[model samples]
Target: DESIDIPYFGELNGIQLVNPIWVKAVPYNVKVVGANNNVVTHLRLWSTEPSKKQLVQDEKYLKMVSKISESLYPDDSTDEGKILRLQQQYLFSSAGIQDAIREHKALGRDIKDLPKYYTFQINDTHPTLIIPELMRILMDEEYMGYDEAWSIVTQVAAYTNHTILAEALEKWNIELFKRLLPRIYQIVEEMDRRFRLFLKGKNLSQDKINHMALIGSHDVRMAHICIYGSFSVNGVAALHTNILKEIELNDFYQIYPEKFNNKTNGVTHRRWLMHINPELVNILDKTVKGNWRKDLSAIKELENFKDDESIQKEIKNMKLAKKRQLIDVIYKDTGVKLDENAIFDIQIKRLHEYKRQSLNIFHVIYLYLRLKKDANFRKTFHPQNFIFGAKAAPSYIMAKYIIEIINRAAQIINNDPETKDLLKVVFVQNYNVTYAEYLFPAADLSEQISTASKEASGTGNMKFMVNGAITIGTMDGANVEIVEYAGIENEIIFGLSAEEVTQAYKANSYNPRKIFDNDKRIQDVFKFIKSLDKDEHYFDFVFNNLLNVDYFFVLADFDAYVEAQSRANKLYQDEKTWWRMSIMNIANAGFFSSDRTIKQYNEEIWHLDTIKL
Candidate 1:
């Protein structure tokens, strides 16, 4: 389809617009059968080939796209790879903006009104090329003046900051920008020159001026470009927003205080609760009045049944049934037999040093040592199954080593007859949303133990809470907000606050070696980990990093985390008390709903209206 008629609000009857051909959007489930005929599924996005004829009406564009597409991308860090990435960014942004302009013209509207009809929310710096691309189109192609183009672009654009990690922030070399996108580069240069002059005119200090520069040290900061070009800028959480203003983007905040705001990230309660836990939904429907599905806040009524023995018994039953489902899943997928009655303590997320799966494994090693050292202790200790699910980036060496250590530890522990029934470890393969549906509803403890001030806002934290899992976390990211909502008593929170962590970094005071040396239990765990039959060379990096780097303060906070885990375990022995706390977690989780987050974005930032279905 070359063009299609869309119902556009106008004095005219019909507006012909470029037709977007919707292709296959389903996820491809590739089943890999092993030697034993056991099957494992790998889910990936379905890909489509570019249509040579349909991509452009002009033969020149078709040839241009084809030629650029043929270029090799070596690695993300290489200069050549960066250049290729910019070329791809320009291709996508230019096409999308051009289509919007073409559609606006088709509706018999002026380009000045583009802001009224269209809004582009750039999720991150990936699509930042759209800023200069839009400016170039208006000035060169549309023959509009620079000031006019700039005004419309700013009016229709917004940016959201997802991560505060320095390495994650995107920057481009000035030479690369000039070579690949000359016209867009010229517009960017102009914007940078104007931004510098604006800061100078305000009588800012030399240091502050340099910090605010769009182009600094021969690199074009994409984040600065985004902040300058967009009408609104926000962080994913309240704490993250404050960090942006107080430190990360302080100069930008000084200039545009109104632009700096917070819209904490949220998870879709529909899939997390309604679809994942239908039995719990049925229980909620019976206990609570009004439509809780449409408006999650109505679920607060569950707090009334928090202490009801019958409701608590039903909650335990629901958890048991979900655990049985997970047991079957683990057996079929990984061939790991699990005790359905054992505590399903889980940590499922992207494997990263900051997220700290290594810390979780270290605690598992500590528990294993305790069981092995004393027979009387092993008999009295509660049975626990530590379940982990994550995939490390291919390039993250330390993270990959952590995954290997987990798997090897699982093999050693599960094979030991003395510990097989008392304590078990299982690392689920190929963790995805499908697996999450089976695991979250069964979780007795949710591991959200990220380093303080590193995690922006974890949507996983909210998902676990909504599904009735008690969070054992530090005061980081949305965990602080979670405790506030669920009540501090309900969650097992430990370690430093964001302020304390920042102060420690400033003073260079944290010493992982001291913690490792002073604690006797830590020594025993380290010895046990060493004695495990594994290749020393493979995990040398993990040992060196923890002993030396300890960048995420894993060792520093180990004792507090262990203590919190003990507290949670002790409560678990009293089934009624634990289920009461679990109910509170669910009842207080309504505020973290995506419905509420979207409404906040609509009202505070986007200013769009809701259309009733």
Candidate 2:
């Protein structure tokens, strides 16, 4: 009966398959439908029969459909086929609203009680249509009028903003919206017109009108709908939320300051730290002598014992044991064996240009060339094993080439006797979630040197920090916050400050070529890249082609990074100091846990408390 109420019955049934746990599915060995001919559809259902005076007077079935539909898609959906999908979204949302109203009535819940029991959390713009959908349910079906339903509807809805990137922002075509949702379009036009009229007598300018208009052009900006419809609108970070208030959605913020808030992102730390490293978790639980699970802040208490040589050795040995487990997996996957004794430097993430695995390679190539070129520079250090695991989004060309270059470089360096002892570079394939658990805890160092302002908030940075590895990262993204939380002496702080980076961009200047010319070490690194004249050449392109275009400010930060890396290599010799830094990093990282972030959100932003599990 509930599925029957949905405008798109088939679509709701599919949603039920994934979402509704009670709906057990029967096996279908048929393979009947042709893949190309068939497509999905969304259903929208309404009581077609005219509402008699008695039906209008009885306020029962009216609000149920409205409430359910609004709850289902309080915002709107954004995908490729805007017209087809918008109709599909509306069908399901409308039926959902209908179902909610019916259930509430059945339970003898009054209109006032609906607000208490029904709280709608609109995830992005995909569900934004719930606004007008509720209005239709209220006014048309129940004869309650528009204004009365909106007040109650807005109170129950909350919105979360996921991305500030313009590409991610959604806008529906005006013609398609009107064609598919004529009644909703009528309400939107009336609302927008009234809004325009509200400001007509005031000193509001054309700029304000252009920015605020809902259905003016094809762009039915979903974020705008989200902000205007809901009582609460939140960004996913302190800095990102600040970006929402101060920059991206400033016009909306100015109109309704109280509505805007920040809820910084949080990972479920249980999966990230505790469950991931059972050996360390067991040690912490046994030695530290308390449950630090809920009160994650209590992990800081472990710092005092970190300096205790016996505990430190035990932790270091546990990391090596994890390394052995990871080595088997790595050898199985990539057919490359690694020594558990060497510096297991790991950089694993999505292969974006901004993340700059190319810079990492350049540094590797630089080290390999120096070992071979410098006659006096004998093998004075433990051989460094550079491990990279990344995947290029099937579309990215340069990223794929970067992968190829790293793989080829590995083959060349791993075989050459002169360079093999000092450095070995390897790119592990198909880096995913399962591999990440093994990769993080085994690392001697975690590379997080993305170009500043490029990475929004790297969850990977926090993972590396709490995993008892020293971070050799730039002062960017969460790395800035990580350095602040960990202290500068505990972690390497290289590259330009946020301010310097901004100023350089503001000046309309930042030359990659100049850095390559002036810095001798940088100059030598590029020269060695060009000097590879082997018949089995790894890189198929000129060295200039690789560094000159320099996608992620690689050449720009080359010297500072090299100098910082030298400091890192030198510090690695003092095992005691390196281990101490690693220990302090893990201890201080308790503050960075998602638990703390969520607590701050409850007190300051959400104004709600957990039921204390």
Candidate 3:
């Protein structure tokens, strides 16, 4: 994507750059942003034949993505990768600045208009050095004075923060910084020095200095730089917004409180709701009496008929039909014959420990053991089709093992005649955005049981809720705001609060061993893994990670999850009650739409006016 260049460059949208390689926008629409803005020109560059370039460079990677049409790219994975990414940033930044100068020279436009026409939004910190890069164009390439270029860079550009996870946040080593981006490093050092002097007169402390240095270090204190340097900054959820201030950015919040804002994330309801489930959409349009398609707040009209039995029956039938369609998909992909009558319990997301597949698996094993021991446990319960869709990061060993265990458990439970009808487990492979559309609408239950404070904000939870699935979640991510929107009774919430998790960590109060030893169900689940004494490698894989590493407190939450799952099953048996709850969830889900989030951003941060044309 990058090389040392004589000219300026900008960016290639990730999708466009990796085109037709994975899932593609089938019928492409050519969108021209402006025919006559009298402003600036930006070129989006791609290899036109990108897959050929990819295959020529890495035949191994090209082969990996063939089955699912997905690629595992790590050309920029190391310190070298970081350097390559930074080089791409500067390439685009300097190119854009110089491109602006060239256009001005040809067109004979006033040079001062650069500020008005040259505003650049660095989508994420992957391009954070762009400010310094732009500075180089002005001072070194453009040969403008230091202060003059710095002024132009500041006025011309801003950034966005994508994630709060520690690993996802990037920071370059000082050595990497010096080797790959020497000139930009000099500009950053100078900026750090000047900022230090500014802080010195204001009576700054050492702690603040260390914090800011790490924040703006070549790795980039991205959210802060985006927030403080840009005209505005915002988070993807209401709770996340408050969280940014209360936790992640507490120091900076005090330093500059008003800068951080909330622009809750939203999905394009067009893709999520309309295109995916046109049948349910038809029923909604007929019953609710308007197209909620354009403005989701119109779903509020559904509140009037929450108690209407006829409408409730229609919604229930519509959901069941969608479930039947999903079963067709399941049959083709995994050769698993699923009963649509069984409760479609689902958990689909990236396979990360913090998302707590361990807790969910413990609950599944606990149920399996209970059924094995108590013969009559089946009579009282509705049969459940526990469906999991996840893809582990190829290098994440524990996550890959988790998938294998889930597959093995599915084989064990599904093949046994006694449990075949009552309980079925299926692990669908290669979970991605395209498959998520099918999973969201077909789900009877959305499992969002991440340990509190771990998931930054789950966009998936909102998607399922909007599709009328009941969420059984924790008080983390967007779930807090979701339960608030849908109201408590409309959804089910379990487990600790973010504050409680933080306090527990501070006190060192959690004990996975004690929890595992006392609860026989949890104990049996662990014992079941170890009792696979027959399968030493698999048990060793599970045990060494759980009992030895034991960091995520999987054992601690196992019982609570079993209790929650049991409660959910009991609710599932009450057909009328479940239908009403599902209705109310969709009715209240308007708040979670990206339309609302974008509107909030346009109002509070970007101040972008709609350019519908």
Clashes per candidate (backbone, < 3 Å): 0, 24, 13
List, residue by residue over 463-499, the lDDT tens digit for candidate 2: 8878788888877666766778678888887886655
Whole-model lDDT values for every prediction: 0.80, 0.68, 0.69
lDDT (10s digit) by residue, model 1, range 1-613:
3221111111211211223221111123466542223545453322222443243336653443454345432245566567556765665566567766877998999888898787787887877878987887788778889899899899988999988887667888887776565556668889989988999999998788887788887888889989999999999888888888897788889899989889998887888999999889988999989678888999999999999999998888988989999999999998888888888899999999999898888888888877877898776677889999998765677787788778888888888886788788989989999999999999999999998888889888998899899999988888888899889989999877778878888999888888888998777766666666555455556777787778888888889988987788788888988999999999999999998998898888778765533
Q: Candidate 1: where are CA atoms >4 Å away?
A: 1-75, 531-537
- Residue-by-residue lDDT tens digits, candidate 3, 384-407: 888898976556788877776787
Model 2, C-alpha of 548: deviation from truth (Å): 8.4
Which scores higher on lDDT, 1 or 2? 1
Residue 293, model 1: Cα distance from true site in angstroms: 0.9
Return the TM-score for each candidate structure. Answer: 0.87, 0.75, 0.84
- Candidate 3 Cα lDDT to native: 0.69
Worst 10 residues of 3 by lDDT: 18-27
TM-score of 3: 0.84
Q: What is the lDDT of residue 345 in candidate 2?
A: 87
